[model samples]
Target: MSVAVYIAVMAGVTYLIRVIPFAMVRKKIKSEFIKSLLYYMPYAILSAMTFPAIFYSTGNTVTAGVGTVTAIVLAYFDLPLIAVAISAAAAAFGVGFLV
Candidate 1:
């Protein structure tokens, strides 16, 4: 297929996937469980996408693991996001240098 045609088809498919859900769901969702699930879906999806990437982001799995643990610990303590990120990166870099 031509590149232009392929791009157009893909765009249409993507648009339809997003649009059809809105078009079909005309009524306000009433169930508390369903509403809660929808509210948290984005966070769940983000974590699902991000958690795996964290393991492979550093050059070595060991370094990545250290970074992830550091981040988790800092986050658990309610540290600022910047602090968590910096500490994690520093830990990963330090571990990388050692290993």
Candidate 2:
């Protein structure tokens, strides 16, 4: 398929996957357990999707680890998102160059 068609199809699929659940569940969910589960679902899914990429995005796992640690430290300190990202990339690059 052409790039535009592929992107359109993927966007439709992603949109449907996210929207269908809300369309089906018109009533407010009453179960606290289920409500809590739904509240945390996005964070859980995001972490699942992102954590593995962080470990493999750099050329080496060691550098990736350094980057991940740097990001976590910066985030813990409530740094801005851009600062966290730039510092993480710099840490990874610096470590990669030195090693």
Candidate 3:
């Protein structure tokens, strides 16, 4: 496919992936279990994205990884997102440069 067509198709698929879930469940979600599940969905997604970086190293959890530990601890305070990103990036780069 051409570059434009490839981008368009990927965008359409991405939108559909997001929309289809809610559209399919809107009417069927009438139970407390589902409601509670949906309520925590955003937090769960955030945790899923954030928590892994802290614990999982190349293939294992490295508690001594100061960069990962620092990032995770700061994340609990609700500081600005950019600060967290920069700190994590700096931690990684600083350690790599020194080693």
Candidate 4:
């Protein structure tokens, strides 16, 4: 198949996946539980998508991985987030030199 056709088909499928859910849900009664579920769904999805980057590594591509972990730990203890992130990134780069 041509590249244009492939792109078009993928785009159509993507649109349908997003549109069908709203169309169906709009026709039905949404409970408070369902409303809350929908409200927090994007954050859940984003976290799910970002979760793995906190650990896995192929080589020394370490900053995004360990940096995220460090940021989370420090933030949990009420540390300044920007400082934690900077420290994590520098630590990762420094660790890469040792490894």
lDDT at position 88, candidate 3:
64
Which stretches in model 4 have alpha-carbon errors above 4 Å? 1-30, 56-65
Q: What is the TM-score of each candidate against the true structure?
A: 0.67, 0.75, 0.56, 0.50
Which of the two, 1 or 3, has more lDDT? 1
**Residues 20-75, model 1: lDDT tens digits:** 87888788778999999989999999899878999999869999999999999999
lDDT of 4 by residue, 1-99 (tens): 799999999999999999987777656655989989989999999788866755653245565566666777887888886788677777677676666
Worst lDDT run of 10 residues, candidate 1, spans 21-30
Q: Order the candidates by TM-score, highest first — what do you get?
A: 2, 1, 3, 4
Best by lDDT: 1
lDDT of each: 0.93, 0.93, 0.72, 0.74
How accurate locally is residue 66 in candidate 1, as Cα lDDT from 0 to 100? 97
Flag the better candidate by lDDT, 1 or 4: 1
> How do the residues 1-99 of candidate 2 rate in per-residue lDDT, one tens digit apiece?
699999999999999999998788677678999989989999999899878888999869999999999999999999999999999999999998788
User: What are the clashing pairs of model 4?
Assistant: none
Which whole-number lDDT from 0 to 100 does residue 96 have in model 4?
69
